[model samples]
Target: MIRKLCIGGIGGVLCLLWGPSGFGLEPFAPRGELRIVDTSPLNWLSIALNVFERLIEIDIDGNLDPGLATGWRWIDDRTLEVTLRQSVVFHNGEAFDAETVRLNWEAYAGLRQPQMMGEFMNFKPGSRLEVVDPSTVRFRFPEPDGAALVKLGRLHMANRQFHEEHGWGEQQWGMLNKAGPWGTGPYRLMDGFSSSQKRSDRIVLEASRQYWAAKQSPRPQRLVFDNTLSRQEALQSINTAEGPVDLVSELRPVEAMSVAQSSFAEQATKRAALVTVFGQLNMRKAGSPWRDVRLRQAINLAVNRQELLGDIKGHGVIIPALAPEGAFGYDAAVTPYPFDPDKARQILQEAGYPDALMLELIAPEELQTQAISISMMLEQVGFTVDLQVLDAGAFQRQTRLKDVDHPPEQRTWDVALRSALDHLNFPPFLLYHDFALDGPSDWVGEEPELRRLYEEILRTVDREQQERLIRQMERHAHEQASFLYLYNPAQLYAVNKAVTFVLHATTLLPLVETSVTDAHWSVRKISGQEGASETRSAQADWNNAEQVALGEKVYVSFCAGCHGANLEGQPDWQKRLPLGNFPAPPHDETGHTWHHPDQWLFDIVKDGGQRFAPPRYRSAMPAYRDMLTDEEIWAVLAFIKSRWPSSIRAEQARVDARGQ
Candidate 1:
């Protein structure tokens, strides 16, 4: 007889007992298909998340989780060794191993593939990958790279068969071929479903039965991504009872409000600070008012971010710079320019624009509402706005560098509305893409101080030093009014109440985790009596003199800035700051640092307090997982434990021993 056993405990796996053949096995139940709607013709993100797999995957809290590779370690400053997950196979049944990694690496090296961060993302010319074993590979770089993991995370690992048949990039094979582009992700593309058959075509994906993580396999048996309807039509369809669309990936404030009121669907929102919406000023344009720093500063002061937030139904954060809060280089101290139309007018008068300065503002159709709002705000403060709206395709062509030989004077628009993804949360990615000399969107021409700072950040592998340099760039950008800093939009999804979907910060639709609850089977929940807390090790090498010394250096460099030089922490550590966040707490015996286990302490330092804290919680502490090694984190913890009194240490050890 078929039986279901709720084995293990809370947060444990649910297994099925199939006629005594096995005690622990996946439940052979039919998981309903999910239908997702988007505005774009081809939802490449949906396909990428479903069909392809990256070397490393970044979670919602910006932690690097293993994807194809189980784990990775730095062999040295210039070398990195990655352990591949074994017994994995691609959709085409090709065994995934070190050789597959080598082939993917070779494909990247052979072709200058178009990437968001440009050529800097690629490995150095002399860099190479060595296959240490079937499931192990080592990457040797010519020089130390602070962005090795960040770069690796973006590299999608396709099989050798894909490369041999279609090569790299979606344009090469995505539309033309249907059976290929095989990947080892949890889902695979359904056969005979061409991505470019028509504008209304839908891409279908099926869950892979041979997936390595069988227990964590996709809940949805099939995923259908449809781009047939417009955003409004999609919203309308979802409001009705018989609509095929289970989820609308994105919705505006007005649409979201409607969805909230509708009985058929509910609104889901996430603080996705991945994409920053800002106005790109053509400062290099000859005789342009934007060339004057005062005018740029005036533009910033003119726009009322609060008003914009209201327009979006309070769905975004008013960012001080291009980078939002929690992102690298985002200094909380650097506040956004307050809305002051009088000051903006005064600044404009001082900059020789006593009368209204007439300028052209170009924007894509997608950002029409935002563009109009900004134009009206600027017009209120000694500015005459000539707004030019274009389709998405036309706007891309307009912003691109027409002639490399000629200066930026040929550019028509004074400012353009644009949004870019800070996917890695690394400041250098934005700096290199937008501000570097002759960069992709080099509207800001040459600036020596900014360039120098950016270069230093690129070279510096030390996280503390890089943070310092990046802050300097942020300050420089703010002072110079590099771009018209706006706000980071929150991703809003309208979903059917019957279906459950978890939103990702990266705006990726992870259908694997999505599921629909119907009459057949519902989501299983374990009893609260089954232990819910995680047990961690109480061990620490506090007695090691060398380790303590190294930890001390690390503490001084990274922690001392906010936590105090002597580990005394902030004066009012227990109390909340003006921003509603608690100040850095002390690591000494007087504080609660010793109350937690060694592994818990290590996790706090590695992942930061933001992940462990509640939603919308703010913390000044930055995650050091990318910057510091595992050994260094343990050493830092050891150093903290060494400072505590013996009695306090003993009590803390007891607490850890009890797994509290």
Candidate 2:
């Protein structure tokens, strides 16, 4: 009998017990424990350490794989249907069902300051993710979202009964001295802590027999997270053998290099730990000095990226950026800030600022990269940088605060460094955060045309239309100079030989797939040992990198003004050719980069993008071929690729196959 089921996915989501609850939790929890120095309840926004995952998990490729929601599909373009596994239970043995789903959203939705809501739609209690049945539910969006399934990864649904039974506040989840707020993950909570102003602490998860995912492979033997949240301590902990801490959140290239060369007991580099480090200037006030493009340019030119990179890291690191130049394209945009104090002086003078102005620079205390040096460099250009270092909680509070009076102009944060976790997907909804939407000042906010275009973006599901709209927004954002778009960072994490964890650009590490053992080495490291060809190919060519660095400087000296960063082509890479071919393909793996063999790759770096293309192309991608040696070109490419993920190389390979 074919039963036509009209199921709504988000509503159908459920968690319940599958197997009999007999021997409590078995010995199948994750033993591959790692330590993050700080895991604060307040750290909810910047980092949560993936406390729990729902049915659909976000994969390394930025795709959503089946998680708590074993299977999901679209009911209609405007709605989504999800089916939950029948036998899953929460950590506290509460039956996972439609009620649990409803409650989790209800709690999170009610909170005035939502940590997860901004990622997707601003979820409201009345925002209706209605339950359909015990095992089936539907997420009725206002419009279609193909990425709806993946979006579930961001939602760590909790046990409705457990949370309501307990309540929140000083007795809240992950508090100063306890671990509550249980979910249906592989591990059940044994104990926990909360977010604070000082140092961070850890939480322990015991194997859960009631957990639905545990039925698949009985979970891990044990899972322990020493959520320290301090990078320095995490780096130290990984060196110890079977200590309190095991894994660290972020390590710069220099740190990675230190691990690579150190005689530490256990160490490994978790791939793709990169993140974009950008300069976000608050452009709310109209007559405010930063509204000037010349001032923005001067601010950009004042900081030397090379020096900043050197300060950030020396090895296992890349300076040029990889993603987000145009979110959809393979554009490895490399915009180097020349160390020209004279030029900066001239530009500032020309902009009517003979002396640098006074401004407040807002940043988190932990970020130590060449990225933040932009503030110091701006000081050289005559700007007084009144540095305001705030804890994560205070920052989030102010950023989200609306009605409060920002004390005079002196107390407000003038510029900050921030990133959009999933900017490519939900664009216009977050425009207010950047553009002057609801502030006392009349800064850059949504205009009539922009709002209309954003509406079209929300309703228009056609992939092409979406891309055009995103590009339009990107163009608008760039022209507004709301942000300096410093550099999209490449993520990195060092692991001991004890565990294997997958990395994702969209989210942090997926601890569910990770496994820890006393194994001496992985097949990955064993195969790519020092003498092997794989190692040779993977071997970083820094001398060549040095050459590329030199050549890039030469290119920047002559080009960059028109060509854009590392030949990103221009702000308008889309509106390129009448012939349907771009004037300049991105230097990223997408552009015609993979089109040439190693020989031509060498030539173009030395020659320039202009030498080979026909007259009609008129590309601004100036020829570095004349300026650089063959090794330098390869080295420069190597530097750029260092920031790009392994997935891009595979795409480039396929591009090579097409012979375009």
lDDT of all predictions, in order shown? 0.73, 0.50
For candidate 1, write residues 1-660 as lDDT tens digits: 556676677765677655544554563332556677866433564476667777788776555789889999877878889999886777555678898999888877776643534676777789899999999999998988877787787787777756765765633222324443378887776532434334336666666645667666777766776766678888888877534788897677767888867877889898855768889898777766677898899999999999988877898898887776667667888889899999999998998889988889999876788889999999999789999999876786767675334556867689898877666777777544554456677788787888888777767567678788888888888898989999988878898888878777667676666667752122222122125574443346789898889888777645664565678876668887544567668888778888887777887786667778875454546455533556788877778878888998898888777764
- The residue-level lDDT of candidate 2 at 233 comes to 64
lDDT of 2 at 605: 56
- lDDT string for model 2 (63-95, tens) is 447776778766666666778767565543346
The candidate 1 region of ten consecutive residues with least summed lDDT is 520-529
Off by over 4 Å in 1: 1-5, 8-13, 16-30, 114-117, 169-177, 192-200, 402-407, 430-432, 435-437, 462-465, 519-660
lDDT of 2 at 476: 54
How many pairs collide in each candidate, listed in order? Answer: 0, 71
lDDT of 1 at 319: 83
For candidate 1, the TM-score is 0.72
TM-scores for candidates 1 onward, in order = 0.72, 0.59
